[model samples]
Target: MQETAVNVLHPLKTAALAAMLVLATGWSAVAATPPDQLLVGMNMNNVLTLDPASATGNDVVPVAANLYDYVVELDLHDPTQVRPGIAESWSIADDRRSIVFRIRSGVKFHLGNPLTAEDVAWSLARTLKINRALASPWKAYGFSAANVERSIEATDASTLTIHLPRPTDPRLVLYTLATSIGAVVLDRKTVLAHEHNGDHGAQWLTTHSAGSGAYALARWRPEDVMLLTRFDGYWRGPAKLRAVVLRHIPESQSLRLMIDRNDLDVAMGMSAPDLNALRHDPNVAVETVASGSMYYVALSMSDPKFADRRVREAIRNLIDYDGINRTIMPNYGVFHQRPVQSALPASLPDPGYALNVAAARKLLAEAGFPDGFKTTIRVLADPPFMNIATSLQSTLAQAGIQAEVLSGTGNQVYGAMRNRDFQIVVGRGGGGMEPDPYSNLRALVYNPDNAASAKLTNFQGWRTSFSDPQINRLIERAERERDGAEQIRLYQQVQQRYDADVGPIFPISQMTNTVVLAKDVHGYFVSPAWTTRLRDVYKQR
Candidate 1:
């Protein structure tokens, strides 16, 4: 692969020209990037919005994390541990229906506005009012627009209290506050100042920011570049790097070439092959972290064919789990067949589903499809997804099932899944942002209503049109259970029931994110929740 130069000038010639120009005109060299600025290359195709109440996908997590501050944060090294952020300390009521957080003093937003408990309360209430993608968790906890104002209130200037409308485990709510972007505290005064038509500043916030964090938004051009400048007055102190430049480069080979030419300090979304090639380079270091998400093939039960339990079981048997994990998922993911992530204690082991063409054919015949049928597999036209779809197509063909691969951007693929308009989709999702088992189960398996009019697009279970009353009951019961041992037992039972009923969403692997960075870049911690903060990242000269 040939390196793509940012300009027409060669490195040495550019350096010499810069020196001559500096001597003649008193100007700094433009050929090399400054040590104080961190250059990052990543795929930003899915970053549709910056509004914390509406943004979806992992691409927006890092951006929101730096521009906003959550009340609490999960530890980078140990995600199970929750640490204070804007809130110094918090207490839960004995009834587990309410919790109060004490906001730290002297925190200031980017615009020099004071951060107070009112901002925290209003920020959370705004999510429920807007009822966008991020509001799903809050809604699941039984908080809605009707009761948000009374339920979440500012007891004082520094104390914010949240009263649950329904019974739930307070720990889960605390985890949500720590991990969800919707929970980020916004400057109430600033946001209301920009409010247009009573949107609560949703429109203005898409291109602007109002939060107390280590960095402030400098500039953002969708699908092109995002710039974050350090905030000197940040409560935790200024970030080590003066600025962060994130460039959206989708092609894996182009990212590889840029990294090799010392043009990019970090590269994300590289293919498995590109990652392998860079693994042995002394100038670059590869870092991998286990994300809480999962990679799976979902069968839409809305289709009559997939509605049959026999057909769903047959399709599960047709997947090449071992082959796909060994060949296509080196740095992408690991073999995991359960819905919950492996880090949770309630998670169950893989049920050992493997490719058995004979068994699948028998099951298909029993389902009244003696000669199999034709279908389409919708997938993103990127690494791992496309590779997984291609492998699945070949395996399904072995059982006399003719399958066609339809690949498009993340929007086209996942958008179709969200609308319940796809036959099958190879995608990645789950509620792994929090360490609790309820997070994954709620996102992946619990579906309260199956009507098309319900439009619960955020839940994968509802999107797949797969729901079991028994599984739903178990999941809800587990979430409200206070006893740790009883909760684990209930979660384990839910997984067993899901497997026995042949759920439509088949989990093949647990997702893992890998990034290649320049050796001199230090303190870059890859977070499992996708909330990676650049506050501590520094370049060693």
Candidate 2:
């Protein structure tokens, strides 16, 4: 409940040496010297928001993950599985309305303070108050300020019980933990200490961190770098890496050069071309994994010009996804996966918007615009999306639809999407190991309130009503079903609806996060949670 104790200058020289022996001779025959250090690189600097409860941007998620610990841990080996982190094991009541967890004993925060039941209660409460800005997954779990307290109680320092409003499915709990938003726990006092700045824990978390994880934040200077040191007193065990340094390099060229020059161990946010080129090099071992994320061109359904189904369809048909796939994401496989799967209620069916000039022309004529109309498209200035946007701009020209490409950062594009300022724009949506399409759809398409809060849903401006009752019911059903099979079925049902509808947006492939590691490093776990479990990882001979 209180902030974890912070101990400085603790040495693990003896333990590290022992670990080296176990790694080399104990398990194998030939013993070799381990590399002294490991280096990693990322495109942008951390969001400078370290509070596990309040941080958002992907840039911060990785680092925050390193510094924080969660009670309900997700099983990366099995996306649907939920494992205990702070808690040792848990049980669900026969009625399924209450779940109880037996907290793991002997656990201490990075600050050296012991973890307790009170802390668990405080962390959950903090999540509810922070809501979407801090952790959308908290809301997804159906947790509310009132419902939380009435349902949650700490039986003891090592025990916690949660009572739900009604007997709901256990699957919801499982999915919720599958997200970083839910997995990120907070230090009660540290979070509460910032209550005056705002109700949310964002203000306090930005500068301070007191988690019970394997690493501690030694220094975090926004725009410059973030430095992390292994927490020797970690409950699980001492981390293998002595330190982690993350530097911000916004320019793709600079990042690539650095990686190629061996100045960096990892480079994130590279374009497909550059990534593909790296894959071919013998010295650079490149690998990609599926990320449950998607990039798409969202058109404002609220706009008068785009309000008509035919007009929306005409514009959709004009999109050349294949052309962009060929020119821009060449290394990426065809048949891009949507950010949201078809199963979610908010999903739109592809508008059958392929590269059919004749069909686009016909649809335009039927929409009473015999001459193709012109529209401006806002896009992120970054590569891949920007390049794809330009390709779209050129493709639309074929259909006599004049398209102007406007470039900006994520914030600017997001702002435009919420306001419906531009006719269309390109953006990405992801996060959550098993996102269950609704995560993407509800946030982007269905929620009317989302249209106003660019902060809530970037594609919320669209008032388009999709007539798919089956999917609508399934969405509700999936949310309640505790059985994995039933949820999967419900997901399939929604996906079918999406295939039939052919909405404006399309699916891109799920991306696997790729990172380079020094040869000395061993035992690293790369999770869909997008965070590295550096505790057991270590340098080897």
Who wins the lDDT comparison?
Answer: 1
lDDT: worst 10-residue window of model 1: 2-11
lDDT of each: 0.87, 0.62
Q: CA shift at 279, candidate 1, in angstroms?
A: 1.0
Q: Which residue pairs clash within candidate 1?
A: none
Off by over 4 Å in 1: 1-33
lDDT of 1 by residue, 1-541 (tens): 2222121101224454344323222211344345777788899888877889988888888888998899999998889888999989999999999999999999988888889898899999999899997898889999999999999999898999999999998888888998899999888898899899999999888777777777777566677766677788899988998777788889999889878877788899998999999999999999999888999999999999999999999999999999999999999999999999996789888899999999999999999998999999999987789999999999999888899999998779989998999999999999988898888899999999999999989899999998899899999899899898999999999999999999999989999988899988999998888898999998886
RMSD of 1: 5.6
**Against the hidden true structure, what lDDT does model 1 obtain?**
0.87
Measured against the true structure, the TM-scores of the candidates, in listed sequence, are 0.93, 0.84
Candidate with top TM-score is 1
Which digits, one per residue and each the tens of the lDDT, describe model 2 over residues 155-199? 888888877765456655655544565456566665565566566
- Summed backbone clashes in each candidate are 0, 26
